[model samples]
Target chain A: MKLLLIITGACLILSFIGDRRKTALGLKKGAMMFLKILPTILTVIIVVSILLYLVPEQKIAGWFGEESGFDGYMAAALVGSISLIQGFIAFPMAGVLVQSGVSYPVIAIFITTLLMVGIMTMPVEARYFGWRMALIRNSLAFVFALVVGVFMGFLWNLF
Target chain B: MRFIKKHGVNIGIIVAFSLFAGYSVYTDYLPGLEILKGNFRTFITELISMLPLMFILIGLFDVWLPKEKVQKHIGAGSGIKGSLLVALLAFMQAGPLYAAFPVAYTLWKKGCSRFNIFIYLGAFSTLKIPMLMFEIGFLGVKFSLLRIVLTMPAVIAIAFIMDRYYAKKSFEIKSLQ
Candidate 1:
């Protein structure tokens, strides 16, 4: 964080030397953009963190672990789809899920889909990629997620 | 009247679905209602904390970068080079798609190909820097690299398939009308 501040400060100094208007413009624009998204991103992170804090790993594992069946996979996928958490958060969640006896496949699928597919961000996706493309990509990704999940589960069993 | 007539069925479906969802949630059948209720305050507070930085970054992108430049570099007719460049840019880019949307919308309007847009999004979502770092840190660099390499082709393939097979269609099934 200190490094980031130093870099940003250097950039600002350079920009100031080069052309004040352009530098000012960039700074102003960056500020506005950051302001708009900060709330939502923070909301997502905090909510996900609190969720991580609250949800017992053992219970999550029980839903998706080795003794579980397709129902576990479904539960995992459903959880992945609904939560808009980042990989930073989700991967730790995956580790917890694994410790709880959740199958590797289920955790893998949950993590993959949680990162790749955005149930919450669908509207943003639709705006950029068009609705059809977003839907198809997400659905296909979901399917591949399942395949990956199963493969990983089987591999984990081998070891 | 004409607009409503055109979208009336879709509207009806959404309303009906929302009503059902609300009713179920209210009745406690949603199962995870506690999470929402439990996390509400903390979530909002965190969101507030992060707001200033997010907006600053967004505003900088908007003010510093010219839409024309982005479009020219990433636009159609640039082919594989453009696609690769878009991928790289998207990969290096930080933050969520929400911040990226203004630039992307400008590019699309200025005639960036559907394929490039798809590739940009595919790469952006999958190949984020923070994620790569985390994977490498925890999973061993080789395993992480392999996964990244494996996933790149998949992302590109998904984009290619969509471009070839599904680009022309609307999201909704026409039959619903």
Candidate 2:
């Protein structure tokens, strides 16, 4: 966050020096973009955070815990696809799971899906690229996330 | 009526959430209101921190980035160098994936190839530098590195696949743009 602030600040200064009018135009565009995106961002936050807060970590771990079978991995992927689990929460949770002996593939599936497959954002994305493309991207992303996870896990075992 | 029409989706969601939350709390099955408070705080904090700066950056780039330059760097047939550049762009970004969409759209307008656009989105999903650093701290360097190595190929492969699909269809991005 600090880094982003510094970079944006520097760019704002450079932009001001380069052309005040364009900088003002940029600010206006920025404001417009923010307003346009507000609803979708809020929608995602409401759905994802609510779903996240609904379930206890222990309950989640129980269902998708280290001791869980393949079902746990599948369940985690589905949840990750639908939800936005912030890195702050997800990475630490994953670290804990790792220490607890959850296999690499399980964590891999979870993290990859969380990053690559966002069902919540599909409506907005589809607005730009069309539903067919959005659907293809997401479903393909889902398969690739799992593929990457399993591949990473296999490589980890090899070494 | 005007206000409701403008805010329909958002209002609808809030109403649904309110009903669900109220029932969950009333039934004593969930701490819906409590969770909503906690989650809302997080939502606000994250939104405030990310949106303003990110949108400004996108706006600035949109204004400043030359079309010829964008095309020369990442347009069709730019190949490996283009992929690397797109990846670097994605790495610099830090926030939710939703935040990257507008930037990607801008790039598309600037004539970035469909393949490179896909690469940018794919890389943004997983290669964020700050996030990677944090992940490494928690998951170990080896684990983090392996995941990146494994994930990059998959991302590229999918980008290639999607690019082909888009190109073959002569996907009319203009319809929406």
Candidate 3:
């Protein structure tokens, strides 16, 4: 954590030193942009946090816990596929979910597929990569996500 | 009408994405489904917050970094540097790829190679700095770092495998006489 902070601090310092005026201008611009987007982000976080507070983690974990078997894995994948979350949001979300007792495997599936196979982002991918490529890529990604989940589950069980 | 014609596909795509997202938000069936509404709220907020910073960064990149320099670094001969470059770019970039279309298109038209473009697209899924920061803070650096490292090989492997097989296949099928 300290290392990460130091790296960020160094980068900031370097950028500041490299071009103070430009960096200041960029920071100002970024601040304005962030302010514009802040409300929506906060609202979503509040809603999700509310849901987190309301839902029973035990119930969720019981259903999709490591002991839940194949059913659990499938449920995880389905949830991930349906969510269509961007990668940025997915990891932290998965982390919180895992901390709440959701299986590591399940969280792994959620994170991998969150970016790999995007049902919501399909058309865009298709436009760029071709439908065949997109479909194949997403399918492969889905398969890999499952693989990742299973692997993580095994690791957790082993370690 | 002209505007519609120009943006027809994009508008359709945005609406379709919204509907699908809305459906999930409304369903609230899964364990986390109820969080959908909140996720939506935060998602838009983050997007708004990051968009300008990103644009400015893009502008800085545009101004300071020479296209040829970027191209060479990410292009065919770059090897691991290229992959790292892709990962860094992906880590730095925000927004879905759809939103990145104009930028990608512009770069492509500006003589960026197909290989680099593919790397960038692949990187799109992997590198997300702000998200990583949040995850590290919330989940612990080890978890985030492990996942990031684990994913690095996976993404790069996929890119390379696709590069070797799919790239050629697409070219053959499309450009054949």
Candidate 4:
């Protein structure tokens, strides 16, 4: 993030050197866009924070890990889609679960849905892609996440 | 009244959460609040460091990069080359999926095809370089490699489905402003 900010600042200076008015115009436009998106972004952030607080990540693995069947993949998929936690956190938690004997396919479903499908962020997505499009995209992701999981089961032959 | 209406949901969320947080503190309940604080710290860090820069970069993209350039590369006819480029762009990015939204929107506005946009989103979510490295560190290369192999085709399939689904539907990206 610091790197990104520094690069942006450097770019701004370069743009200023090239054309002051255009640089000003770009800044104004960006600020406006930022303000416009702020509310929805904040709302999503709060909702997600509260959710993580309430559910906790530990409980999520147990939802499907013990099942080791069709139902297990479904449960993991559902948990993952709903949680939508960051990869930084999710991957480590998943790694711990894997070490603890959670099936590879279950972890696959969990990780895929967690990353690809976001039930919580659908409103934000709908804001850009429209409700129907968001629904279709997420549905497709959900199905494919499951498919990915099933394929993992076959590839690993662990479950 | 108009302003409140405009931001009603966000205001409601903040006010309600604040009250709840205060009550939690007064009542000696702080686990949730503590978690919230941690999450907020992370969120604010990203907000401060990445988002504003992202917005301005998007602005620069808007001001400088022409629609024809985006279209010629990632639009309907760009095909496999476009998909590879989009994947590379997604791999280079280091932010969360939501941060990619505006960038994707900018690309869309600049004439990127629906297919490439979906590819960009999927690839951004899963194929990012730093995140991939982190995943490998945690999950091991074999597991991570299998995941990438499994996910790539799925992403492309979904992208194909999304493109075909939206191929006929006339739609507009809702303006938040």
State candidate 4's TM-score. Answer: 0.59
- What Cα-based lDDT does every candidate model obtain? 0.59, 0.74, 0.59, 0.74
Worst 10 residues of 1 chain A by lDDT: A37-46
DockQ of each: 0.22, 0.36, 0.21, 0.37
lDDT of 1 by residue, B1-177 (tens): 754565565556545545654775778854345444444444445334433333333344445555445445655534888787777667766555555555556556656676776677677766665345344333334444544554576677777887787556542211111
What is the clash count for each candidate, in the order shown? 19, 0, 11, 0
TM-score of chain A of 4: 0.59
* Higher-ranked by TM-score: 1 or 3: 3
TM-score of chain B of 4: 0.55
DockQ of 4: 0.37
Model 3: runs farther than 4 Å from truth? A1-18, A156-159, B1-88, B99-118, B164-168, B172-177
Task: Work out candidate 2's RMSD over C-alphas.
Answer: 8.1
Off by more than 4 A, model 1: A1-59, A67-69, A128-130, A154-159, B1-77, B97-100, B138-150, B166-177
Write down the RMSD of all candidates, one decimal each.
Answer: 10.7, 8.1, 8.6, 8.8
lDDT of candidate 3 over A63-157, digit per residue (tens): 77767777888887777765755543455456556756777777767776776667777777667656786676677667767776776766655
The residue-by-residue lDDT of candidate 2 on B2-46, one tens digit each, is 556887898789778778777867886556666666765565575
